[model samples]
Target: MQTTISLEIQRYRPEQESEPVYQSYEVPLRKDWVILDALNYIKDNLDGSLSYRWSCRMGVCGSCGMMANGTPVLTCATFLETYAPGPIRVEPLINFPVIRDLIIDMSEFITKLKQMKPWIVREEEQPLSDGEYLQTPDQLTEYKQYSMCINCMLCYAACPIVGLEPGFLGPAAIALAQRYNFDNRDQGKKQRTEILKEDNGIYECTFVGECSIVCPKSVDPAGAIQRYKVAAAAEWWKSLLLPWGNR
Candidate 1:
């Protein structure tokens, strides 16, 4: 069996370099080690200047997301043995500006997420004495899958639309908007629809389905966008047919 592996990690220091470059480091190959483990080895032993993001090595925190051999993945969850006996290429998530090595800027994603209003909005707040807004098992199930998103930004990297149309609201944001839209206790669906129906919103998604395929959490963002399109079309037809009725 091979005793070691090589990782070609992308490096970028704006003050030092005008463009990103790859720097390679060799580390021990162990069956128990994941991609993050190799990265940690590089950071600690090989080169302390090597930079990346990671937390909760258990895969709960989405910070360890990176391009592993050209695929977007959570490094903590991807085992090194899967790409054994050779070099692995690691790069920052695409479709966003790289702040530094292995760390992409998330400001755009954050702005779009805020537009989704990823919380339960109410037309009228119920009194505290009225008790918490309750939901049944079925109601909880409606948005459970989307709620699993850890904001890893893997979906954004997998989405071609995000690369082409920089203004397009990426997959995770739309899926989260649907999460709140489906919640029984939320009254923010109407508000979210206004944003989603816009040019750079849900309509921009061409339904390539790669976003869902790469999602580590199984949050089917592509399906969510399609569902929203269907609903939006239906609403449009209804409004056209019944001019006098309240939408």
Candidate 2:
């Protein structure tokens, strides 16, 4: 007998429905199939009207993030065999306005990302004649952990802080900022510090750690935020003690 599992997917179509609703579909339960495979089956065989985002089924693109059984996870990495002989609840990431089925408005996230200035900012560009800036392995190791972020937004969905304060900078963005902050070649820490010191910045986070728990790349955004807090505090003290010195 062929085995199958039920998937209860949340749907929201502005043209057809004013509110979101659950729609169930059955797909073969295969040992090697991830959740993306089942969703593909549904899109190809069962329903053509379904809408979702997915790329690089190998889990590098980070486009297929969704709420699976009440937890934010990458569908490309989640296997169906893990939840056999039953139904799985799949929904779009929470704490964001739904665009359609399994798609949410990421405009806010993108705006926050830009606010962080997650890039190398040198005061004066080294002339091409100077050649590319070089760094030792130890320097690379300083920010390597935070560099694994794929911008999947799973952290935002899992973060209670984001749910409470929509303006908060959130986790992944801060972590990526920290990545550049830790880079030896970068020189924009002071600029980023002022922005992150705002009322709705890292101070708003209550440290629930759900963002770190849901990160597929092990970026540990919670840890990054804490590190930034400590760094920001030290800078504050330095300004208090040495007001005459350049901050």
Candidate 3:
């Protein structure tokens, strides 16, 4: 017997709709199909109006993230059989404003990422003899786990605080910042901390930890936020004692 799957998608078309709404579709499914494949089926066969983002269907691109069956799962990684024998709910990742359908306005997330200066800052000029900055395996291990972030923003979507506060730096960006901060080769932690102390910096997170739970790449953004908080708190205390501490 052939199986038909029910897909309930959340639709938002900013050009025409005042609010987003859910639209359901019955799709013919193969047992091995992934959620993204089902979505493509809808787009290819049923509804051309459905909108979402996807690149590198293999899941490395991190563009296909969405809330599937109520949890934030990369659509490419979430197989249909997991939510099968029944209907499934597909919606845009939460916390950001929906641009249209499952494609949210990631501008907010991207802006914060750039604002964090998520890169290594060289403190000293490279010496001719020293060559490139060397990272020992242990040093690499210290932050290698965090560096796996694909910038999928699932952590941001899962974070309720980010949902409540649009200005918050959110998860993925903070994790990326933490990645550089923890790197032994990095020396700009102090300068970056200045910006981190702003209104939407580390203080914005209430530590609910939903970001870590929903992260698809296993990047522990909550832990990174906590570690950054420790550093920030120390810096704050140091500022109280020394006027130039944060400067």
Candidate 4:
């Protein structure tokens, strides 16, 4: 069995250099070690200056997402053995500004997520006596798939539209918008639809489908955008045909 593997990690220190560079480090090839483990090894034993973002070592936090061999993946979940016996290239997620060595600036993603209003939105809050909004199993299932997104942003890295059009709302955000739109308790679909109907919204996506492919949670953001498009078109036609009907 191979005793070690080489990792070509991208390094960027704004104070020292203007361009990003690859720095290679040899790490023990243990069966139980994931990419995050190798990175920790490098930071702890080899170089303390190496920087990255990670939390909850478990994959749930979604903070350890990065490009592993040019593919977006959760470093904590991708085992080093998968790319064994050779050099594996690791970089910060693309389509975002790198804040440091491996941490990309995620302010844009956060702003887009806020635009989607991921929480259940209601026009009027029911009185406390009315109790919490009740939802059946079927109602929950409507948006359950999209709710799985942990904001890993791997989908954005894999999306060509996002790379081509910075103004595009991106995959995860649109999917999350659908999550709220489909929620039985949410009444803000009209407002969200207006936002999504903009040029930078779902229409910008050519549906390359890589977003869904790279999603760690099977969020299927491409599908969500398509579904939204269909629904929006239907609503537009209905409004046009029946001016007397409530919008």
Candidate 5:
């Protein structure tokens, strides 16, 4: 007997339907196939109208994030064999407006990321003749872990704070902010601190911790956010105590 598995996918079409619906397909269950391969089979051979977003088949691009069996995961890296002898539910990442089938509108996420300014900020540009900004290995390690976020938004999907408070700056945005803030070369820590200290920023996170659990890259955004909170609190105290000094 041939092995097969059922894929129940959530689909949304704004033009034809007001709300989302589920569609099912059965595909060959191969040991080596991942969830993405099953989706491709459905698109190519079964249903052409079914829509979703994916770029690099490898895990690097992070474009294939989706909810598999009620958990946000990278489809490219989640193998079908894990969910073996049965049906699997696949849907768009939660906590965002669905654009179509599996693509969530990330315009808000992009805007928040921009607000954090996840880049090195210098008060003045250094001349090229001065040579590159140098960092020791210990300094590099400070921010390298948080720099692995690929903007997949899986963290957003898993974060309860995002679901409860739509305006909150989500995990990836805050983590990326810290990524730059930790860099010895970055001079924008004060600016980023002001932004993150806002009402809808890090304070909004209740630390349910689902964000870190769902991250495919193991970025540990939850840890970064907590660390940032500590720094922000310390800065606030310093400002209060030494108003005469440049804190």
Candidate 6:
């Protein structure tokens, strides 16, 4: 059976126009084909001028994230059958400035990630003679879920907080921060609390639950942020209850 896939794609040509607009393309597609495949077909056969990003079609690389039918998803993982009743409206992820076509600029997210110190900091001055940092099964389970983030920025795309307040560190970075903060081998939670507890930190999250819903990886970023909030609040209470505890 021949299927016609209708795509209303967002477009911007810097040399020709000042603003971006939507352009339609109808292509014969296989029902089994993924949205990314149809996008590739359009780029190859219909419009060579179209621009987007994709790599490692297995969904691990996360380079192909776009608004598929108004939802933020990895194009490689989104099947045409998922939205088969009618036309699929494709656009760049919301709450971000469009660079061109399906591409949205992520410089702001990347820069914020660098400021949070997302990696583990070692306390020992000497090299590890133990070869590897040991972790209990429960300890691994604690942060293992948060560590699965692919940095796809889908949660950021789904985040209304980041859109409204640019200072908000957003989901992915906060999730990453939690990943390290929860790690058993890490001893930097005190230092790391500054970033996670600041104005744009966990407080910025209104518990909209959108971040957890749109997450493709099943990473509960909202939970991670909330866990940190509870911890920070308890620490605040501790400081008030016993001044010498923090001192």
lDDT winner = 4
Candidate with better TM-score, 4 vs 6: 4
Model 1 worst lDDT window (10 residues): 238-247
lDDT by residue (tens digit), candidate 6, 12-69: 8777779888899887767778888888999999999999999998979888888887
TM-scores, in order shown? 0.98, 0.98, 0.91, 0.98, 0.97, 0.95
| Residue 198 CA displacement from its true place in model 6, Å | 1.4
lDDT of 2 by residue, 2-111 (tens): 49999999999999999999999999999899999999999999999999999899878989999999999999999998887769999999998999999988999999
- Give the clash count for each candidate: 0, 0, 0, 0, 0, 0
Prediction 6 TM-score vs. true: 0.95
Clashing pairs in 3: none
Q: After superposition, how far is residue 139 of candidate 1 from its true place, in Å?
A: 0.8
CA deviation > 4 Å runs, candidate 6: none
C-alpha-based local distance difference test score of model 4? 0.94
- Alpha-carbon deviation at 30 in model 1, angstroms: 0.6
Quote the positional error of residue 171 for candidate 1 in Å.
Answer: 0.5
Q: List ranges where model 4 is wrong by over 4 Å.
A: none
- Once fitted onto the true fold, the runs of candidate 2 whose alpha carbons sit more than 4 angstroms away are none
Candidate RMSDs in Å, in order, are 0.8, 1.0, 2.2, 1.0, 1.1, 1.4
Tens digit per residue, CA lDDT, model 1, 136-167: 99999999999999999999999999999999
Q: Which model is ahead, 3 or 6, in terms of lDDT? A: 3
Global lDDT of each candidate: 0.93, 0.93, 0.86, 0.94, 0.93, 0.85
Clash count for candidate 6 is 0
TM-score quality measure for candidate 4: 0.98
Q: Give the TM-score of candidate 1.
A: 0.98
> Model 3: how far is 191 from its true place, Å?
1.6
